[model samples]
Target chain A: MLCSDSDLPAPPQEALDALCLRGARLLSGPVWAAAEVALAAPVVEAVALQGGRIEVFLRTPAAPDEALCGVLEDSADLEAALNVLWSGIDAILPEDTARTADATRRGP
Target chain B: MGDLDRLNSKLAKLKGKDDGQIRASATDSIVSALLTEIEETILPREMILTNESGNRFVLVVAGRRLLALSGHGAEEEGSEGREDAAARIIAVFRGPFRTFLDNAREISIDAARPPNRIDPTMIGCSVETLTAALVGPGQASVADPVAAACDLAVAGLRLVGGDVVGRSGDAAHLARLEQFAGVGGAGLGQLAGDDTDAPCCVFLSDAGREDAILARIAFRGAAALILAPPEARAELIALCREPIPAAG
Candidate 1:
């Protein structure tokens, strides 16, 4: 039940559920099952006991010397974990920023 | 040199480095690309979680380990539990080729004894795979990637210089990479033999230099493995919120 971007009608709960389930059934059964077990609301809340919210200040995008605390006061736990998982990518930024910046000075 | 000349040099240099009925095969540029990948993918740069549709998702992570994620998405628009985002996220973490090249994500594990929500099997499998693929007899951490690069550089050096250390080298640099893994005494015969169908020269090039720099690896005629500058590793891990206890 795929819909074109321009004419996307409000999909029903069951159809949306089916669409989501179909998106991930191919990876592995156990992985889906395990995640389904943990992704339950109660299970997701249990993460708070294990270290709910990690403090990720803004050092990479702005001044590292004076890092700013992030604002995630109202977001859910699973979303937080997913956010941090992507954050590790910052570890591998190229060391040649100055050189590239110099090269970019001549760009149109 | 011209691109064609460089291409021929690359082709001449690459004999059995790419294709064969062998256990493994890799080239210096491919290795360079790996380093570039490690550099671009391993660390955190921002605390914001931007999704694929250019929207933002919000959350904070603490140790049991806390880091930031960028460009993560939920399959159907919704919250955590009801949504299968966790399943999708796990699949991405445990997915193929460093979690799919376009959407690479990190996997969580407990090298030391604290636990997190991720399935134990996922960590175990990734550890075993990373160990068998690159790490030798040690836990996977910063050292695993550093060792992989040095191993490639070392093997490349042996091919072009006819010796592991070549003619000139920095003893400190060689010792440092050697400490990361058991990548010592990798001989030329291990990669290619004159009597075999795979006969060619392969070189291990350092990141910014036209020739090898650290350990002065392969200065005689070709480049071999050597430690990248300590600063590169330092800068890479600088962004992680919690210190990864030194990899053994």
Candidate 2:
């Protein structure tokens, strides 16, 4: 359930819940979430959720000096935004032995 | 002498020297000459990014580094103004090229990090794809997809005298771009002969080394060469003034 009062609309609450769930799913895997994740892997540096809108701050290792922003109106738009973020992370992540091992264990 | 004439003479003089020596000499002369021209032609006001605090950051796109001013401020504290500021900044920078954000409010700015570096892929596409993604579907302003793509890629780069070369569809050539993964400028030379159909973009980092490097890649049919510091625009334009004869 989204961390909102009972008065909030269902669609927006559902969308926020989905976004958090997605973040949680990523955490369940090899990835971990923290402000420090910006130090290494691409991570969500900041997020703003309010009034049925979701905004994400993405810092990528490829260009550490910059952050990319993505906004989603509701749960319907969350997947596309997530896809953009994940694609960028994949682009920068090293394709080395350890990464390969982790990915292999994670499976498709 | 005319700019092209002077450049030709310089190239002629570099003919007999070692390949590295000639390239270094040519690059230096070109950069020196162009810096003067850039200052006189392009106004500084045109490049300034005017927002709230007037903070400047380095934006690197397609290998070119540009000084971008912060146009939005996270005023009012909390997250209320943060994402809006980021969206405004991105919209301002990308607006000139007709790129639009689907959900500007969904974007957030990581104020904790210095806003200098920009990874082109962060938007989930190559510089090329980002350009296309921003375009609204059924837009009548864009008639030719290939030309539009090339224009999009070049526009994304904050280059002064930069121009796209080779094929415009190169941006759509993803298989070729994959080869550049994890490789910086050092490993770029190895990509010379890999795929004839593949297209790539170039940006000159240093003055001395770039002449030879640019020449070599130009010979290999790279898509574009962006002169950095914006001061090198004059020289880069002159060096690339004539179409390089494709490698035999």
Candidate 3:
């Protein structure tokens, strides 16, 4: 979508990365897959796949605003979203990541 | 005459009941309605998800003040076809987000995304899962099924390494969603902004193993789901109280 809106400046990839470092969250999928639901990625202006990382350019919520999914102000909103989405869907990350998650699961 | 009529009739029968009886009935009626509305909005049927123990339950979202309710459904593996997938995808990514995806396709980033390719059965609980999880076992009250669900969700987060960190951090431009707390300032749904609709975005990020774990944890929260059996806390506690697994 950012490509079409070329007139408008794309938000820097660094901004979203900063949020990620600060633990800001973003969802990476196209909005259409509910059955394969992941958490909501905030204002996704652009997306790129450099090597392994899918560099998503997101518009940081500048003010108290309404999102289609979670509350805007909630920082942990992304984390919460991921929790719900991944309850069933699996291994969106590399297989190794999934193994790590499985490792953490306290088995009976 | 119908469902509401039947519900009303049931309520009428309880009119002369004792205070305790009336409160319990009222709580059940109101809470069930909240859960049912969300369920119908998401799932095509009253299908309930169960675990190895045969414990039957579902998840739903409870908003802050009020969050938007999405009626669309997400897609899964056994699809009818590409057309079916396209239709479902369109349904999920409505409004401004649709624009976001539309532009995204031009560069074909979706094709390049491998780490994001998901087995829906593993993540995205469908709409049936998310809001339902938020509706939780604790939405009704402090001692209701909604509270218990919330506790389970909290445990689920903890299981995935999502801990309650302090609100204040360094002088950074943004703080993680963990910093904010939800109702009663308890750190629930902190990022659940007073938004319009729910059942939002699908997750696809390529972070480290730890970030992946965190993402999965966030996906759990977004899905708002857990596999805890819904039981009465009071009676269960009196019966030696095998704790609700890892709840807060």
Candidate 4:
């Protein structure tokens, strides 16, 4: 399934578009897929190609963790990859949200 | 009576209490007594109190004389509340008796000390005592360099990319380390000669040589690179996106 920009939360539109464009270009071969997960601090972009290779990038922070990139040879591997990325993103979002909330309350 | 005697008498009510309770009571007593003295002597002036931890408490005294200190009559709107300032002062106090005495002495001697006099050695001084002497009871606090750097790195770094490579132990098992060694613009040869074991290095350079420079550092075991030029960010991200070669 193709991922839409609306799938992500409140990230900068420009960054989300750029991330999706890059993902599409990189995964243009056989089965291309892209997902953007909106997060308070940084939006997460996950791109997967037919060979099961996936690249994840964090939008605002711009950090990339390529350790998870590998060929997804089967459905089980795809499920495991999705679980790992979603779990990692879920874990980081709460802390980021709390920090953003705290900063807002403290004022500039 | 001497200032110490006055402070001691004021704090006498805190005697016969446990150490923690004594300290707590002493700080409250000292802050109240000091603020009262400041109101009487200094009149209506704006002042800030800072503790060793770099916390600041501001007091805006309202009155004609206080306004005259700042060459104005209208009360300064939005001055920091007195209760918050007092609480901050109490939080950093070490020993109630010593801190109160020292704070009192500083207030009493503020006009006598030379404006150009360097601060006395703070080698065994608590943060509250040091700050009390330096800032006095009704003075503004100065910025602390270390704290400022920490705030900048923590808060300001949001615009810059947060951790590009996962920190120390995120799968790469890279050690958490930071070091400033070698001058900028050094060739790969100099970097190789210096400590390659440092997990991160920031290079000062124009964007043109980034690709070659980045590849060289990656080969030299630098897990992360922070380029100085803003234009280098995209190139750096692209470099990071490249797949790691298979281990032979």
**TM-score against truth, every candidate:** 0.21, 0.18, 0.17, 0.16
List the lowest-lDDT window of 10 residues for candidate 2 chain B.
Answer: B100-109
Off by over 4 Å in 2: A11-17, A26-28, A31-42, A46-108, B1-248
Candidate 3 lDDT over A9-106, as tens digits, reads 55587754443432233332222121012212223222221111223323322221211121121111233333343343333334665565466564
Residues B1-248 of candidate 1: C-alpha lDDT, one tens digit per residue: 74324433433333223232121112322222322322333222222322233444322122221221223343322233533333333333323222222231211111122233433222111222322333224324323332333443322223243334432235544444343213322332222113321111211112122322222122213333343342332222211111122333
In the range B36-58, model 4's lDDT, one tens digit per residue, is 44445433334443333343333
**What's model 3's lDDT at B123?**
24
Model 3 chain A lDDT-worst window of ten: A66-75
DockQ for model 1 equals 0.01
For each prediction in turn, the share of the native Cα contacts (below 8 Å between chains A and B) that it retains comes to 0.00, 0.00, 0.00, 0.00
Selected candidate, larger TM-score, 1 vs 2? 1
Can you write out model 2's per-residue Cα lDDT over B119-205, one digit (the tens) per residue? 443321132232332333543223222222233332221111223233322342322222222122223233222233222222222
Residue A24, model 2, lDDT: 39
Instruction: Please identify model 1 stretches exceeding 4 Å from their true place.
Output: A1-108, B1-54, B58-72, B76-88, B92-141, B155-208, B216-248
Question: Against the true structure, whose lDDT is highest?
Answer: 2
Q: For all candidates listed, what's the TM-score of chain B alone?
A: 0.24, 0.19, 0.20, 0.20
Q: What is the C-alpha RMSD of each candidate to the true structure, in Å?
A: 27.7, 25.0, 23.8, 22.5
Better of 2 and 4 by lDDT: 2
lDDT of 2 at B243: 18
Q: Pull out the clashing pairs in model 4.
A: A9-A38, A52-A72, B44-B66
Off by over 4 Å in 3: A5-108, B1-191, B195-206, B209-248
TM-score of chain B of 2: 0.19
Per-candidate total of colliding backbone pairs: 25, 7, 67, 3
Alpha-carbon deviation at A68 in model 2, angstroms = 18
